[model samples]
Target: MTDLDPFTDLLDYPMYVVTAQADTERAGCLVGFASQCSIQPARFMVWLSKANRTCRVAERADRLAVHLLRRDQGRLARLFGAETGDRTDKFTDAPWHPGPGGSPILDEVPAWFVGRVEKRIDGGDHVGFLLAPETARNLTGSRTPLLTLHDTHDITPGHPAN
Candidate 1:
């Protein structure tokens, strides 16, 4: 696995904030593993760390919201990436509204979508949540660039990796 570090380190993917709600509990976290897995039916997949609070909440959630941050929104990235929800109220600190399926939509995100959880796949330390997009929007229009892993490389992980 150590041999793969060099190859993996070279990959710089876009980062996202995934939010979930179940009952009265709400959680969100910065995610580095997510992509559009299908085009015909428009399916997306977001992998959440097993150790993350958001992942725990998502286990019972029917839906989740994925948000794309702008390149300039480093502060927002840090808030979600560097602060653990176990000790911090991330939703109260950030401006957001209840979106489709009761997922929290961060106001600062440039683009976002609410997706129904289609399936859950166990992927090592992370669990992949296959999503079927229910609603989507581009708050900052189409030209806005998304923040990538390179843009957030300096930030530390809020949740400990399992």
Candidate 2:
């Protein structure tokens, strides 16, 4: 197999905070793997590590909210990325409101969308949630620079990828 690490070393793809709600349980995590996979049908996919608590909650969640953080919102990124949800209630410090299907939507994000989980695909260490967007909100007029992986190098993952 060819090494794919080098290909993404210079790429600075935008980061996202993915939140989910199942029953009374809620989980959110900083995600690096997500993208719009379709055009006409308007589909998106977010990959969550199986080891993370958010992935566990997301398994039972009917919907997931993907939030786009601005370049200046690095604190929110660290809050979601560096802390593990297993031992902490991440929502206590972060202000949010129930969104489509009751998924938690961060109030501080520049843009966000709630999508129904259409399918879950097994992808080695991560599970890809295929989403069909139902509701979306954009407050930045699509002009704000988004937080990217390159901006989050200092923080460590709350859960190990493998």
Candidate 3:
């Protein structure tokens, strides 16, 4: 805390709810480090913290689901953003459905998709998964106010892997 201030630089970018399924179990969390890495093939990469319970379930998953939350869905963000999957069943409180490969996609998000895991790379504290979308759904308008890091000030990671 002497000179390093990650929070100062973390306020930008949109927040997303990432989900995945393995067997009968589904897991997800609010992801900050994700991007559309490829435009030609329309690929996206989402980083899951190693300490996240979702990460563990995703390890054996062949598909993952990603969702975009509205700015007004602050409470939804906190449920997945601040609560620890370690002791909480996130789906119990959120409405969702099994998408491609059985990945649970949140129902209230503006947009959501189930993707096939193309590849995975170890990135120190987190694991990056490259996803090729298999099926997608747009639940809201593109002009919707998306949830951003700035809107999640009241929510803290219940499980900080780092």
Per-residue lDDT for 5-65 in model 1, tens only?
Answer: 8898999898999999999999999999999999989999999999889999999999999
Worst 10 residues of 3 by lDDT: 2-11
**Candidate 1: TM-score?**
0.96
Off by over 4 Å in 2: none
- Model 1 residue 1 CA deviation in Å: 6.6
lDDT, candidate 1, at 98 = 93
Per-residue alpha-carbon lDDT of model 2 for 6-122, expressed as tens digits?
887878999999999999999999999999999989999999999999999999999999999998988899899989999889999899999888999999999999999999999
Candidate 3 lDDT, 57-89, residue by residue in tens? 999999999999999999899999899888899
Order the candidate numbers by lDDT, best to worst.
2, 1, 3
Question: In candidate 1, what residue range of length 10 has the lowest lDDT sum?
Answer: 138-147
Clashing residue pairs, candidate 2? Answer: none
Candidate number with greatest lDDT: 2
TM-score for each prediction? 0.96, 0.97, 0.92
In terms of TM-score, which candidate is strongest?
2
Clashes of each: 0, 0, 0
RMSD of 3: 2.0
